[model samples]
Target: MTLDPPSTVSTTSRRGTATAATRVLGVLTIVMIGWLGVFGLLLSPADRDQGDAVRIMYVHVPSVWLAYLAFIVTALASAVHLFGKSHSMQADRVAGASAEIGVVFMAVTLVTGMLWGRITWGVYWQWDARLTTTALLFISYIGYLAVRGLEGSRSQRARRSAIVGLLAVLEVPLVHWSVRLWRSLHQEATVLGTDLDVSLDGLMLFSLFVGVVAFTLLFLWLLLHRSRVLTMIDLSAETGLDAALAQRRAEGGVTA
Candidate 1:
């Protein structure tokens, strides 16, 4: 039996329902992010040395946090898709969603790192260990996503992407330790570093915390939408393939 795609009205209703549910959360996200920006920009005291340039931390730090968070999620989803008895398509959708989000955030991290670098290091880019590993991490996931686009069965695509995703995750730890591993202009970790000897003051730290929270919520919302879209796209592709095959079979029967 050929299963048609949902009627436009049905699709619209579902989308409307999703929008309504996310509406309140979206508003809160915006409000919190706006407040964080204002607080970081206007109220927070500047660093004695970097002065106003330090304002970039609110965005850059959150970007890195969310980027790492997204990749971790992708790796988990990929693992489930690969190893679970059911080998669920749902897991694949989730992995794709998180990878897409991760790539965007990683790109943002790179760009902001460059801008921040220009201010603190007097250059937009350098051969620093952290910067180099971070760039590799970004490119590796880009390849992960690219693998999904290759011609193959659903299972085949999932298998390849799963392996790529799992391997790509190793870079996260390396990037995190790049500072401690080698002398780099990039500052060592604030929260994860062994030393509590951090430089961020109370207000600056608070703003950064707010940034992470806000971006995490944003990632959740976006991930929900992205996964749903990926599911629909896969379903549509499968349906079209089925329909074409059915049509060809019918034609051959008539010809015989």
Candidate 2:
């Protein structure tokens, strides 16, 4: 059966997912992105070594960081859905939302990294440990999202995807540590390295920090809206199914 349009859905669903707080969050995300563009793209000083090529790191670093954070959130939400006392569908929704966002950011990380690599290393692609593991990480989450799209009851789909999510997330640590674990062309962490010493220039560091904060805010905003959208979609489908079943029973002269 086809799902009803949002306009035709029940009053509770009609209220939609937006709120004053979400509106404020959306506004804040926009403002932070604008600030990041100024500082990260324009104002930040170019690296003496990498020159203007280094500016891309402001976006690339934050994208990978947020991708990791999003996948971690997905795993946590999936765990809550599977093992928590309530086993709430809300957790499943959050897991799906976070996974989708993680995949998008992962794609961003790969594209930006390839561009930067071409500029610095004279190649758009490499078989380096970090790059190879990162490509695998991206493909794994794509599979996770595909699993979520499989046909089943909500709980069944959630359980299947949850298991995959937990398994898929194990790859994150491998991707993060690949540089150190193997002979890779990828550079080790700068700001978040083992040494704890910051190697970037003062203004560049601040701009990178802003990029992180801005992307974090954007992720939160997107996650909130996406999860609510998933909730409404499920609710609408269940409502439509119930209505169809009721009509079929009426036509068959059956009583509940």
The total of clashing pairs for model 2 equals: 0
lDDT of 2: 0.89
**C-alpha positional error of residue 238 in candidate 1 after TM-score superposition, expressed in Å:** 2.0
lDDT of 1 by residue, 1-256 (tens): 1112223424335542245446666878898899888888988889999998988988898988999999999899899989999987788888988999999999999998899889988999988899999999999999999998889999899988988988899899999999999998788898678786766799988888888899998887778777767777786688788888888989888532
The window of 10 residues in a row where model 1 has the poorest summed lDDT is: 1-10
Superposed Cα deviation of residue 30, candidate 2 (Å): 0.7
lDDT digits (tens) for residues 1-256 of candidate 2: 1112234445465556666677898899899889989998899998887899998998999999999999999999999999998887888899999999999999999999999999999999989899999999999999999999999988899999999999999999999988878988999888987789998899999999999999999888888888878878887799899999999999999985
Report model 2's TM-score to 2 decimal places: 0.93
Q: Which 10 successive residues of model 2 have the least lDDT summed?
A: 1-10
Model 1, stretches more than 4 Å misplaced?
1-19, 249-256
| lDDT for each candidate structure | 0.84, 0.89
